[model samples]
Target: MSIVKIVEQALKDGYLTSAMEAEVGRICNAASELSIEEYMALDRLMGALLTGEVVVLPRKQFINVMEELVLAEAIAKVAEIEATSEQNLDVGDIAAYALNRLPPLYATTEEGANFQRARAKEELQEFISKQVKEAIAQSLNKPEFFPERQALGTSSKEEVISQVSNLLQAYAPEFEPQNDQGTSSS
Candidate 1:
């Protein structure tokens, strides 16, 4: 949807969802220059946001406690290994590998998170350690097939903007800029 449509929806709903925010950011980044209408819509959105008429929802409302457990295990092991030898393991890779193999423990509240953490410690501590060890071993042995490959879910705003711009250009081949007269320019 266009920026104007998204703004209208947010106004009607009294909330700006993360997806809507991302979409607006994508559209704004994709366009070479904002039209008057688009600018006006953005202004309205800004005003509404400032006035608390449209609330912006957080990107994530829950946490996966398992990720924390795995990361802690991985970091400890990596630190120990790095301390002894010249080998510097990627803690992120180890944590990600272990996390993928383990079940997620999602919690929306602190109490729930503490409960899950305690449960995992009681039941899955050994398993979590084993997974982290296996992940470290695999990471050590795995060849750097794509050393240049960037990690997922870690894109900066500039990178996201560029990606959105590229996607728009690739997908919307027929899209044209609107001239000041409100007519599409060839």
Candidate 2:
């Protein structure tokens, strides 16, 4: 079978990778007897395949091929920037391409955006935890809430303070205090 047919079949089966595409193009080019019309026709076929209408769960082999293809392209972009005499390489375009070529797991823009949001949430949680710890430490020395605590039980100040800290930690696991050695009290 011709390289074009192989590419078409691989694409239809959802197993085509960028590396395979480039290799197939090279093979097609080597066949000098192919007319301009033939090349253009192949281009059209490839273009149709990229229309995003066809969604399939890609095979593991294809997934591996895609990772290598994207990584190589990203590395090449970095190398090109390094080789250029101009120092102010924006690199934004390459970064965008690399991000767009991420795995099938991040197939849509929403998936990528959601992943970023999750990372931001984790960072926000950490920041809030630090703030809560500081607030708890300062409040530990205060007597403002001691009157209310006495009405509940015969607990001493130390016990009351520990209980308050525990309650705070229960509400926010990230706020769980560190021990003397700076590890979590878990």
Candidate 3:
């Protein structure tokens, strides 16, 4: 007989007394409560991880399969949220954020030096780009007339504005090559 049938027969034969049934229910309830607590802890941990508030050791330094499992669970949560939510969600961004926060899983000899270097490079590029854009805007917003602008045949404010727009579009294609105003390019 199947396990389910055997269990049914035992229960029907009064093998599982009222006390035993009550105890089983209590145990199941306790287990359900414990599982809820475990899930909550995991959710908090994953949020901390994705938000860069927590760190996990790399596989080389500390081989903890639980870390991987937690990450997997976090990813699964994001995926579930994305699938169910009406609004669009960026699962890739969540994955990237979690991965960036976690230590290097494959290469441990370098101690995440390469990852740090890449992030630094990206930050530096962003900073420099911001500075350059701000400088351009400030220069263009000046009231004073510029001989250089005149020489470039863009002495008029309209010409300067157009040039700025063009430069912005080239620097950031998300600005839309055709749209001069700040609006959704998509």
TM, every model: 0.67, 0.24, 0.19
Candidate 2 lDDT, tens digit per residue, 97-165?
Answer: 443434322223434444543453345434333433333334334556434534244346456446534
Candidate 1 Cα deviation (angstroms), residue 93: 1.2
lDDT of each: 0.81, 0.45, 0.41
Q: If both were scored by TM-score, which would come out higher, candidate 2 or candidate 3? A: 2
- Residue-wise C-alpha lDDT for candidate 3, range 1-186, written one tens digit per residue: 322332343334524334434544555466635455445544554565566554443333322222232233343454465577653332233333444444443323334434443453345434433433343334335565544534245546566447544543443333222244734357
lDDT ranking, best first: 1, 2, 3
**Runs in model 2 lying further than 4 Å from the true structure:** 35-41, 53-186
Best by TM-score: 1
TM-score of 1: 0.67
